[model samples]
Target: MDVLGQLVAVPTVNPPGESYGEMVEVLHSIMEDAGYEVSAVEVPRDYLERYIPQHADHPRYVVIARVGSGRPVIHFNSHYDVVPPGEGWSRDPFRLSVEGDLVYGRGVVDMKGGMAAAILAAQAAAMAGAGDFGTVELSFTPDEETGGETGVKYMVEAGLVSPDYVVVPEASGSGNVWIGNKGNLWAEVEVRGRQAHGSTPWLGLNAFDGMARLAVALSEELNSMLSSRRSSYPFADPREAAPTVTLGGAVSGGAKVNVVPGRYSFTVDRRLIPEEGLEEAERELREALERASAPLRSAGYSVELRVTSRSPPSVIDPRGRLASALSDAVREVTGSPPRLTVCPGGLDTRYFQLAGVEALTYGPGDDSYAHAADERNSVSEMMTVARVYALLISSLLSCPGGPPRSTSS
Candidate 1:
């Protein structure tokens, strides 16, 4: 609880990421005090300048802690960054509030609680002399709330970690384990027209009208296309099994109520299922935009589209040795087997999986409350997840085990 309090107090929000140095220091101190060798690896300024130039002044860091040595290393990872706290909070978002078993704060459920749990679990396993069999590694990374360009992805690309198995303690539900997550494709579209007085609207073109047309076209074409395709992977909701598109997440247009807007722009969020291929998805979106814009162009409006980011879907066999070991630990600690499912959201596990390392996610808290106004986590659930992690570390690293077979979707 004390550890969780310290973590929650530092609001490491990730758009232009705040207090990253302080957060890394806190994690480093915790891991160092736990009798593990720790390293605070900072992302290079050049990389930052090239990729995220707006955040060049804000440094990024990943705290890595390692105990013991040898083959079949088990790595536990959690991102320390949290989303910005929006409106409607009853209490201070940065202050940790405890009521009975509930712990409330901005990042409590979205995953600083999971970070604390992983730390405690690693400490407990180390104290039990579980290091005799193999190595246990813990990484507290940054930029997951955005993309992990400088966090897990950077580490994997720079050869900072080479683990046989990885466990990402994301905010999966108490009785659930996430073996995979959906991919994301973010894009922005812009339209240009002439500005003129609203009283004589025919004197100038309306950019907003073009934007509306494109939105309608997307709703008619993209939505219908997505409806016909569904994933074979199991999800609690059938709707989650299909790809989804959300438009106008951020939109702006018009100079004033009395003026015709000269320019308009909006964002797009497309989530791809595990079975979907990235190239095909991109091609479909591009084709849709091209078809929709032809009419707008003929009507004297200029349209432009930009794909800001792309993350391909990643998955692993749910019945593999890593999943079995973690599930056994969950059952041992919670007295019931956890259901293995594909997360409908994006996760950092994709980075590890892309590196050819088997990975899965299991932790406390309901993911539905992740970015909610009153995000909270259960104290008892946190402890239960900690015990589960410690037991899994002991199970896999306390004895010799062969390398698990590689499997992917």
Candidate 2:
């Protein structure tokens, strides 16, 4: 709880990804005190983007704590960045506001609390000589809320961590381990038109209108497939829960009401189920977009698409060693086995999976409260996860440098 409070106090909002350096130090110092050799790596230059203006000046730091050099290195990762604390709030978004058992604050449920739990748990495991049992790597990353190209993605691509197993303390319900997540394709599409006085309507093309046509046409063509592609993952909105596309995250173009829009741009959030092939899905979308934009092209306009990010759907083998160890640890700590879940959204676990390393997420936060106004986490839940993490670490760090025994000591 103490660690969680300190974490929530730092406002690491992701829109522009600010104050990452501060967050990195807090996590670094705490783990260093617990006997881990920590490293702070700046977010790579190539990863920075002008779209996130803050990065042009504000530095992003990925803090990594290495406790041992043993084999079967197990990684516990969590992003420190939180979404904006929108709208009404009873207390300061950066400070922890408590009631009964709930700890209210921005980033509490979505993940900072989870990050704290991992840190404390790692501290306990280190005290138990768990590091020598096997390697334990705890990474605190930023830029997750905004696609992690500059955070986890950077670390993974740079060979910062090559763990045999990874446990990301993302918001995965009470203590359920998230074995996989539906993939995502985050893209921005633009429609171009010639600017002219709005009074002379026929003199110029309206990019906004052209974009509207494209959206409608794509929807008409893809909505059916989205609805019919039955997903194996369990979601509350099953009827409409298949692979899907959400268009127009935000729209921009016209500068004046009297001027024809010269250009229009919008974002797309496309979710992919495990069964859906990413290439096939992207190809289909491109085909649909090309077909829809044909009319606009003939009319002397243009369409351009920028794929900001793409993550393939992750479906880990649930019976793997890491999953088994976590399950055992959770059962020991909570008196029942934890359930395996498939998330509807993306997570840093996807990057580890991309490298063929088995990874899962099980943490303290309540998913329902994530990114919502007055986001909060239960102190009791955080404590429970900390205990479970300690147990899992000790078990996985057992005898062999590579695999745990049939049961932990």
Best by lDDT: 1
**Residue 296 error for model 2, in Å?**
3.9
lDDT of 1 by residue, 1-409 (tens): 8899999899898888899999988888888899999998889999888778998899999888998877568899999999999999999998999999999999898789898899999999889876666788999888988788878888899989889889998889778998888998989989998899999999999999989988888767788889888899877677789999999999988899999998999998999999898889889988888887889889889988889899998889988889899999999998999988888888899999888888999889988888889899999999999999998888886544556423210
TM-score of each model, in listed order: 0.95, 0.90
Top candidate when judged by TM-score against the true structure = 1
TM-score, cand. 1 vs. native = 0.95
**After best superposition, candidate 2 residue 152: deviation in angstroms?**
1.3
Off by over 4 Å in 1: 404-409
lDDT at 231, model 2: 71
Per-residue lDDT of candidate 2, residues 1-409 (tens digit): 6787888888898777767778878877788898999899987564675435556566788888987675768789999999888898878989888898889999888798888888888888788887556688888888888777777888898998878789988878555888888888878889999999989989999999999998888777778657667876655346534788999988888989899998999888788888888788888888878887898899999999888778899879888888888999999888998888788888888888888889998888778898888888888998898899888887777734455433211
Q: Backbone clash tally for model 2?
A: 0
